[model samples]
Target: MTGSRSSSRRALLGAGAVLIPVAAVAVPVVQRAAERSAFLALCAAWHEAKDTHEQFYADNVRTFEDEQRVAGEIDRLDNVALRLEREIAGAPARTCAEMHAKAKVAERMGERASEDIAHSLVADILREGPGA
Candidate 1:
């Protein structure tokens, strides 16, 4: 009877060892899925902003001052992109909600830049020619 009990214990331990690796694999899969979803959402928002900004510039409505302003804004946006990329690459990562919040902030910044450029262009057109 004692020998039978020892055999049963060993079987249970062996089963537990097998489960550890399965659990490990499952955990990373779940984490990767969440990260991919968050990344897709973020990319969607960024693309929308990019498309809108492109449309805004399609009017050929910029002035000399507007060009300078846009140049500065583009520099700033580039920096933001680099920083966000780094943050995304390094973990402990944030949830989808947190990523959306960050994306919203970026969207707002882009919107503000667009507005500023439009206003500058309109003002320049009203004030004088391209030389001014």
Candidate 2:
């Protein structure tokens, strides 16, 4: 009985050794394909949302509606989103420290863009003589 149990254990160990490499290779391929699919899905959604937003703005423009406030807000949002995209694209190439630094830069850029948009919106309101 002891000899049979030992043999069974050795067989299991041997099987694991053979399985490990197959799993190691397959896991990464599966993960990468899933990641690519997710990225494509997100890109499609982003494009659809962008198109919808643009169409609404275009219709307003056709009516000669005042869109300075809306435009400023959208510009700030778009800039922040663009910075986020840069960070996401850099993620695979970056170490943890590098990614952190890149994230800090993106945050700073987003903050500055928001501030500039606010300043522009205020200026436009003042120049346009009200409610802009």
Candidate 3:
């Protein structure tokens, strides 16, 4: 019984030793995948917000004040998009491929939230009365 217990313990330790390296390798890959997904989602959301802002400008922005406000929002979105682009460029090739594969899905999911953000901004602008 003592020999059997010792052999079982040794087998368990051996298995753990093999698993430790695998887990170590897997953790970074999983973390990178999560980070890539988050980055892509942010980019998709930014695109939606920028598109909504442009549409609002085209359809509803009549006054100079409203135009200026919308333009500023568009510029802000552009700057963030540029930053995201830079990050994407720096990402690993595999990460980029995975992100590209998933981007459209993320964009579709983000559209509603982006519209909400745009609506909130428009409401604030309207409440502030154009020039205020």
Candidate 4:
């Protein structure tokens, strides 16, 4: 009876030993899967925002600026935003300031760069009479 008890104890210990290695390997795989899920979630959210929302801003053009030049400035702001994304290469956990570093860059780009993209997007509305 004592021998049977000893054999069962060894079997339990053997099972635990095998499970230890499996758990060790599984832990990192699970962590990486979680990180991947987080990254994809952020990316998906960013895309959803772009698809579902429109940016709005006011642009007061000086007497001298042409429409073509205004459009080009908006394009340049977009390029700056794109460059910032590449530079930041970051996760969603980044601070709001960090996330908007691009817009800040656009604001710095020129007097109207910050508003150009939104302005160009709705030029017709601005040109048309008010909604009231």
TM-score leader:
3
Error of 3 at 99 (Å): 7.9
Q: Across residues 34-93, which tens digit of lDDT does each residue of candidate 1 receive?
A: 876766555555555555556555543378776565776655556554454444333222
Superposing every Cα of model 4 onto the true structure, what RMSD results? 15.1
The 0-to-1 C-alpha lDDT of every candidate, in the order given, reads 0.55, 0.54, 0.59, 0.49
Model with the higher TM-score, candidate 2 or 4: 2
| lDDT score, candidate 2, position 83 | 51
Model 4: lDDT of residue 46? 41
How would you encode candidate 3's per-residue C-alpha lDDT over 56-95 as one tens digit per residue?
6688578888778678766776676555544433433234
Best by lDDT: 3
- TM-score-best of 1 and 3: 3
Tens-digit per-residue lDDT, 1-132, candidate 4: 999999999999999999999999999999867865664454444444333322411353444554455666556555655544343243332223332433333344456443443343234234333661
Candidate 2 lDDT over 18-69, as tens digits, reads: 9999999999999877765554444444445456556767765544345764
Q: Of models 1 and 2, which has the larger lDDT?
A: 1
Clashes of each: 0, 0, 0, 0
